[model samples]
Target chain A: MKSIKILERLLAAIPIMIGVAILVFLFVRLTPGDPVDLMMGSAGSVSQQEIQALQEEFDLDKPLHVQLYIFLKDVVRGDLGDSFTQREPVTDIIGRALPATIELAFGAAFFAVLFAIPIGVYSAVKQNSITDRLSMAFSFLGISMPAFWFGIILIIVFGVKLGWLPISGRLDYGFNFPSVTGLYLIDTVLARDWPALKNAVLHLILPSIALGMQLLAVLARVTRSSMLEVLRQDYVTLARAKGLREFIVIVKHALRNALIPTITVLGIQIGVLLGGNMIIETVFAWPGLGRLAVDSIFSRDFPLIQGVVMIYAFTYVIANLVVDVLYTYINPKITL
Target chain B: MLEIKNLAMAFETERGLVRAVNKVDLSVAEGEVMGIVGESGCGKSVTLLNILGLVPHPGKVLSGEIMFQGEDLLKKSKKEMRDIRGKDIAMIFQDPMTTLNPVFRIGEQIRESMRIHGLFKDVKGGFFKSARKHAEKDRAVELMEEVGIPSPETRYHNFPHEFSGGMQQRALIAIGLSCKPKLLLADEPTTALDVTIQAQILALMQKINQEHGAGIILVTHDLGVAAEFCHKIAVMYAGRIVEQGRTEQVMDNPHHPYTQGLLRSIPKMSSKKDRIEPIPGGVPDLAELKEECAFYPRCAKAHDKCLSQEVPMFDAGEGHTVRCYLYG
Candidate 1:
């Protein structure tokens, strides 16, 4: 039965993926700039004949339906088409950049959850105490600030004023390191370059913080309310009556049940984090899919935009699917 | 085995400190079943929760001496109270559906209470961890069997949601009895069950009381169930025990007006009254407490003097007591 449900989810993702592909493909064309001008490096700089030749070279002269049909056909053949901007295949660009995005997004989510859950649980247990009030106040402040703005403020404080860290970018460009898996942190370790690894980590810290802080607030608030609700549950009271330690009662009994709803929210937050990364990556000059997608959009790289958007959509669907599967493990009462 | 003297518990609400339990005095001898009967919010549950140190926030035990086996439980530290709970004193709540953790197997939950008390620590005169685990599992199965669960070995793996409501209560009862507590406090143990299930649960509690010799404090609103299962009854009104005595004495001759009102309200099979007599007026709000008797506003026998003076418990014959001006 569970396998059937999983199969159904996989089947459901197909139409959604197709819908996303069609939308991104159509939307990229509606934008003002033309890829011909971008490829030529300026508008009207190249002769009409050269522009026409270039259009023919990439099949940009073809009608929308024919282009979409070719795109879909190529996608089926495991090809995302070549980048109209980068002069490399879209797949190769994604392969090189996807890990950095994954690391940033997952790292941000990991940081958010690690701190938010404990803060939430403690706030709930101590409802009106000073710590609860202060954390809640800070969460409100966090919610109010846009992530990109926060990223800039972090840059000002740590990057410029204190001069404690790099102002922007994923690494010190002068350093040479192995490119295993295209994720600098892992690649540095594989190369056994400790200094480069340290440089990569320091560069990642600001961007991850900017991306994670908003999510942390949201997760903490959700967790706090969820925990408060679960703490009042009769089972928690029963745990207390059983002479279980206060810590066990709050953490094991209450927080375990509390995490179900928090996990659901966290799943949605993953999608939010992916979207927020675009702005954050732009500010920090982080090399990730968000940065690549935005750059592709500005360059009118239709195939690249569509490719990146499709990947984002697929990731979101999978994240939600994972959360649904986790519900069963967390609470046996939930069958699926 | 247990005694509560001059217990006053209060909750700080917007209105004021709402006194929940007002200078209440009660006791239960070893192997005895003491029933505390009252309407909802009459402090029956609060009294028991206070004894368990499970009273929620903003509700403070203002002053009290809870003497259990010569130790004043109110004086014990949080750690000391934890040691006493589950091992020396166990509680079964009203709704079994809500009380049992839904995620855990019934056997694990039963074992958890005993595990907290380290029941399996000295297993077979050796502290082998695996041996202790095996013994606890076996004991959990035994508890399941003792509570009349059929095929205990097989049912031990079932979650609380898998069990029927009656069975969940039985599983909870098994947990309560797991550590072999000297005192068992049950708050409306059968209120959520059907009549037959209620009877079965009551019978099971009776068996536990007799077989294990655990003193039981049965708190319920149902006088009928109390009469059937309890040796003595304490009738509460407005957060105070208005009358208490041997169950037969209280049932045969209810002295306090509120107690009489309660007795009159119970539908009788023998009598053919067209309408049951409900006690007039709702209970007074605890916030606006006056020096005079709280029952004065609702009492059918309230006099001018009853409105002005405080009422005190006046001893009647045969260990019976009534808090009323008539008795005073």
Candidate 2:
């Protein structure tokens, strides 16, 4: 079963890579920046020989189709090449930045699901009541406000005004950790660095809130509507007739069934989040792939752009594949 | 024995308060099968839902009482009443398609009520706790097999979609009969099934009743089914029972005009008739029927008196009753 899913993801990514390669090939030529001039420093006096050499160095002078072929071959071989702006391997930059976004994404998703499931369940169970109205109102506000905007609001309220938490990046300058895992808090905890862990938590709080708040709204509203429909099923009446406790009826019977759609929504949300991270990473000044991709696109760094788009596409495919497996487990009737 | 004395039910609607079941008196012996026959919206199912305490809100029992085993059930709290449901009194709904949870394994769904009705509430020994869950599964499998599943072991993990329509109804029956409740309310259990499956399910119900002595309230619109299985029957109109009597007598010699019309309307296989009788109009509006005999507007026998005044129910004979101006 696991192998089947891996095979499915591999198949899905192939088309996505082809589509992305075409886009990267087209967009790089359309953009204004001359890679040769940028590399040679337009501010200083440079010869045509130097310009031609630099263009050939990165194989920039190749025809569009050939360039696409080279990029595809390198991508398949797990080579993302050097960054035009950062002057480092694009993969190393991505590797260093991934944990920050991952920490934010997982933390936010965890918090969202933890709070949303209960709130959605209660709002659905107590539908048309004051509690339901309140949850609906809150969810609307959460979804409507952009995460970056929400982050700014949080920074002002919690960091600037209330002065409760630190405002920006992951760690305090002096803080050190044992590099056991890439995650800051986990590494600090493994190293038994309590102060570093505290600093990590403080730094992660606002970004987590920014991400968690949006997913919380999306998941809760979905949970509420989905549960409302699920609760109407005759099985719920059967559950009630059986004399199971109300909570048990909702949680054990209804919620899991309701989660079928919500699980799909979560997987889709992950895809959306990967794309939205460009905005989030920029706003929070977090050195994640989103920031890297944004800087690469601005500099017309075609190779880096190709790598990021393909990776993001691949991430989405894997997430959907996982959701598919989960769907099968939740509903035994599902064939694939 | 379960006895309902002067039971009245009303729904608070947008227009006004409408009485659904009015001042009704009924009793079922420990081992009797009673049928409540009525057209749609005649409150037969609602009455059963009321008795089960499964009636939706804003639809309330206005007055009277439901006594189950010498205890007034209406006065009991939800928590206390839950203990009685599916343990002492179980119910199977009309549509088998909707009856069982679609997402659950057939065995798991069967054991849900079993576990909740305190089927495993007993057996305190430490060794028994681990064995009890397994015992519940064993019992579920046995019930499924008893209901005539081809292979209980393989089918136990299968869901509702895996079962045929007949099998689904049978599965529903298996679930209802699982705990062997003292009273079972089967509301239109055969309505959604085909004629063959319907006959099979009706026969199954009769078998369960004769073997287990589970008193049943078979709420259905089909007088033929009621005539065949139920000993006594209640025929309702709008929201009230217009005629009720022993099934043999009622089907053979129906007293009320509404009852007579309903019986004549059925297409009988024995009769060599060119055309079956068709009752001309639909059931009366429930919200408008509180003022008079609900069938008055449609009944050929109706007069000015029938329109102006409410017709009270009268005892016609031994355990027989009819509500009409003629009887009144």
Candidate 3:
């Protein structure tokens, strides 16, 4: 039964992916700049015939309907075409940058969950205390501050001023570690190079914090409110009446019910973390998909932009699917 | 088994401090079923919560001595109180629908208290932890069967929502009886249930009392239920016990005007009276209560002297007491 439900959900995503494809295809075309003109404009003066030839070569000369048809056809056949500027297959470029983005996104999520839950639960349990007030104030500050601005502040304080961490790139220069999975941290661990692993972790700390600040703040507030509400539930009272320790009452009885809403927020925030990391990636000079996307947009690389967006849409669908599946496990009353 | 002396609890409300339970004193011997009868807002539930020290925030025990097995529960630390709760004195709440956690299976919740108090820790020593777990499950199933639930083995895996309201109450009672507590405090355990189910739950409680020999303090507004199930009855009015005695003594030969009014309010089968007589007024606001009789405004037999001084418990008959100026 569960498998059938999951399969149905996966089948329903097809139309959504197709809709994204059509929208992205038309939206990229509607933009002011033409990829052919931009590519040739930088090469000094060129003839109209030469421009027409380049346009035809890239299939930009076709009518909008015909172009959409061809694009959809190629997408179905697993072909994303070549970037107009980089002149490489869009899939190959995405493959190279995909690992870095996945690494950063998961790192930020890890940091957020590690700190947010405890902070949220503590604030709720000790509501209105000094620590609770202070943590809430900090979370408020985190939410109000922009990710890029936080990233710059972190760079200034931790990178330029104290020289405590690296400011740019995945690792310091001349650190040779075999790329097993393309994620520097995992690769370092796989190679069992402790110094490289340490350096990789140091590089990750600042960007992950900056990228995850808003998510952590939002998650903490959601967890706090959810927990506060669940603590008033009769089951929690019953648990306490059953002589369970306060810790067990809060964690075993209350936290699981509270996590239902928190998990929903987490699912939505992960999509935001992936899409909104563009500016943070640029600020931190991290070699990830967000930076690649920014570069592709500036050069009017339609295939590259389209490819990146499709991946993002696919990720969102999968994230929501995982959340729906998680509901069944967390609450028996909820079916797939 | 349990004794309460001068126990008072106050809540900080928007208007002012409301003493929810005031100077309430009662006692119950082992295996005895004591019923605290009162209307809504008369502090019956608060008095029960006070016994377990489980009152919600903004309300606190003002002054009290809850002696259980010769030790004042009020003097126990929070940890000590926790140790005593569920292990020595377990409590069941009103709404069975909301009392059990929805996410967990029935048997797991029943096993939780045993797990908390480490009930069977010495059976096979620490090494056979899995063996101890098996024993706990077996005991939980035994409890489920004892509570009159059908097919205990299969029902153990079901969640609270899967069970009917009566079955949920049974599961809750199973949890209450898991550790075999010496005293059970039930606050309107059958108010949310239908008449037949109410009778069934009360029968189950009576059985638990008879078999386990655990004292029970039941809070209810239905005098019929109290008369049917309890050995002694304490009638509360505005946070004070107005009359208390043997159930037959209080029900048949009630002394206080409030007790007489309560009895008259119950609809009878043989009496040709068209309508039952309801007490004239609602319970007085507990916050504004003065030293005079709280039932004075509602009592049909009120006199001037009843308002002149505070009324205290006066001996009405053998092992019976009534709080009234007339009795004084």
Candidate 4:
């Protein structure tokens, strides 16, 4: 029964996927830019014939319907087309960058969950205390601060002034770490390069913290409110009256029930974190899909833009689906 | 055995300090069933929660001594209270639907109290922890069966929501009795259930009270339930016990006007009349309470003197007490 529901959800996603493809295709094409002029290196200096030849060669000369037909056909064949500027398949470029983005997303989410839950639970348990007030103030600051501004501040403080860590890039030059997962930290560990791993982590800290700040704030607030509400429940009162330890009453009885809504917020935060990675990646000079999208937009790389949009939409859909599945596990009463 | 003396619990509300429970004294001997009967906001439930030390935030136990089995529970630390709570005293809430944790299975919840009090270690001498777990599971099933739950093994694994209201109350009772507590405080356990389910749950509770020899404090507004189930009945009015006596005496000859009103409100099966007599006025606001009789405004037989001076508990008859100026 559960598998059938999962299948139904997957089937429901097809129309959304198609809609994203058409929207991305039209949006990239309708934007005020020309890939032919970009490829010429000097706009209007190149002969009209050169531009025409480049357009014809890249099939940009085709009509909208014909182009969409060809794009959809290629998409059906598991092909996302090639990057116009790099002259390589968009899939291959994305595969290399995808690992970095995944690592950042997971790392930021891990950090947020690690600190947010404890802080939230503590704040709720000690509600109206000075600690609760202070932590809530910090959460407000985190929520209100933009990732771009936060990232820059981190860089200026830790990189420029303190000179404790690298200002940009995934790792230092001349490190020969094996590329196992394409994520530098993992690759360094795989190759047993301790210094490279340390360098990779040091680089990850600022961007991850900046990227996770909003998510952390949201998670903490949700967890706090959820816990406070759950703690008021009769079950929690009964658990306490049952003579269970305070820790068990709060954690086992209260937290487990409280976590359901927090998990939903987490899934949404994952998608938002991925979106924030665009600015974060650009700020850190990190090679990820969001940065690639930014670069593609500048150069009018239609295929790359469309591919990145499609992937982002796909990940968002999957994240929500995964959260729904997790909801069933956390609360068995939830059928879907 | 449980004894409470001068227990005054108050809540600081926006209006003012509302003394929810006022100078309440109660005692229940071992293996006895005592019922606290009152209308809503009369502090019946609050008195029970204060005994369990489960009063919610903004509420304080002003001055009280809850002596249970020779020790003062009020003087004990929170940690000590926790130790006494499930092992020695357990409480069942009013709403069965919301009382049990929805995320956990019935069997697990039933076993939780035992696990918390380390009943397995006491029974098994701390050997074969895995086997002890299985034994506990077996005991949980046994408890489910004991509470009259059908197909105990199968129903034990079900979540709280999967069970009906009556079944959920049974599961709650099962959990309450898991550790063999010497005292059980049930606060309107059947209020949320239908008439038939209410009867079943009451019967189940009565069975547990008899079989386990747990001193049960049943809090309810229904005088019929109190008369049927409890050995003694204490009628509360605005946080004070207006009248208390053995169940038969209280039922036969209610002394205080409030207790008399409560008995009159119960729908008699033999009566051909369609409408039952409800007490005239609502319970007085705890915030506006004064030293005079709280039931003065609502008492059908209130005299001028009843509104002027404080009414204290007066010995009316053999083993019966009534808090009224008329009793003097």
DockQ of each: 0.80, 0.69, 0.85, 0.85
Candidate 1 chain B lDDT trough over 10 residues, lowest sum: B121-130
Report the lDDT tens digits of candidate 3 across residue range A267-312: 9888877776899889888888899999999989999999999988
Q: Distance from true position, residue A310, model 4, in Å?
A: 0.8
Report how far off residue B96 is in candidate 1 (Å).
1.5
The alpha-carbon RMSD over the true interface for every model, in angstroms, is 0.8, 1.3, 0.7, 0.8
CA shift of B50, model 1, Å? 1.0
**lDDT, ranked from best to worst:** 3, 1, 4, 2
Candidate 3 stretches greater than 4 Å from native: A42-44, B125-128
Error of 1 at A210 (Å): 0.6
Clashing pairs in 3: none
- Candidate achieving higher lDDT, 1 or 3: 3
Local accuracy of candidate 1 as per-residue lDDT tens digits, B160-278: 88999999999999999999999999999999999999999999999999999999999999999999999999998778888999999998999998889988998888898888999
Error of 2 at A77 (Å): 1.3
lDDT, residue A239, candidate 4: 91
Give the DockQ-based CAPRI class for model 4: high
True contacts kept of each: 0.76, 0.61, 0.78, 0.87
The window of 10 residues in a row where model 4 chain A has the poorest summed lDDT is A36-45
Rank candidates by TM-score, best first.
3, 4, 1, 2
In candidate 1, which residue pairs clash? none
For model 1, the stretches where C-alpha displacement exceeds 4 angstroms are: A1-8, A41-44, A173-180, A185-196, B124-128
Per-residue accuracy of model 4 over B98-124 as CA lDDT, tens digit each: 989999998899988888788886555
